[model samples]
Target: MMGRLARQGGLAVGERIRFDGQVRLVLAVTGRAVILSELTSEPRLVPPAALFADGDFEIVDISGRMPLPPLSLLETLPQPVLEKALWWEGHILEILHGQAPDAPQGAEVRPEYAPTRSLTARERAKAGW
Candidate 1:
């Protein structure tokens, strides 16, 4: 009874839901989004409001029985996401490696790594920098 209530009113990981006339496994749920694994070889984060707008989803009795891949394994991060992550990582690495702007040569200082009192310079340093 409680499970049925949760399935109807709240999101439950491992639940099998019929959405848009297709079965999908619930992998995770946020305040306004649900991560669902469909048959597209990747999972997708969908807004609950969108599903509610469709008005065609139903909680299956087999809910909470379907197994899904871990969050890290889900191919939900698209190319743009990867690109952004790469850019962020590169920026962070630049700061950590102290590859800051050469103040004398008119190189633009990265906003995140402006020269400060606690400055230390590094080059060719790796992850632990």
Candidate 2:
């Protein structure tokens, strides 16, 4: 079901879709609506569900992930910098996932309630959040 939904209506900005009798480009996707336009007409925000419900609908091309900018990097960073970047990514994932990343195998420890460590600044901040 998710795959079908994506194929039919999960359009991204700059994606070209063969809609109606001509090709239209997705200008933007906001909330439940998709803004689309062709060279001959002004853009219109239409519900994706309704836009793809009927008529000729096909994804012609996807420019959603234009990579020309990233491809310009000619050299990798220093090893230490790369390691720090990776560590930063882990921190971002921890926040996004609402928990710290798991320990490596054999490093897991049982949960313990340390009364002495209670109400610390970090714990207080977490509770406030």
Tell me, by TM-score, which candidate is best: 2
Question: What total of clashing residue pairs does each candidate reach?
Answer: 0, 0
- Model 2: lDDT equals 0.53
Clashing pairs in 1: none
* Candidate 1: 10-residue stretch with minimal lDDT: 115-124
Task: List candidate 2 stretches off by more than 4 Å.
Answer: 1-5, 67-129
What would the per-residue lDDT of candidate 1 be over residues 1-129, giving only the tens digit for each residue?
A: 233333323555566787888888877666568789979678888897776555567776443223222446234688788668656655543543223222234355444443221223322133235
Put down candidate 2 lDDT per residue, 12-115, tens digits, no spaces. 55678877777887775655687888576688778867777746777888543322234123238777776686676554333222234444433422222111
List the global CA lDDT of all models. 0.54, 0.53
TM-score of each: 0.41, 0.44
Q: Any idea what lDDT model 1 has? A: 0.54
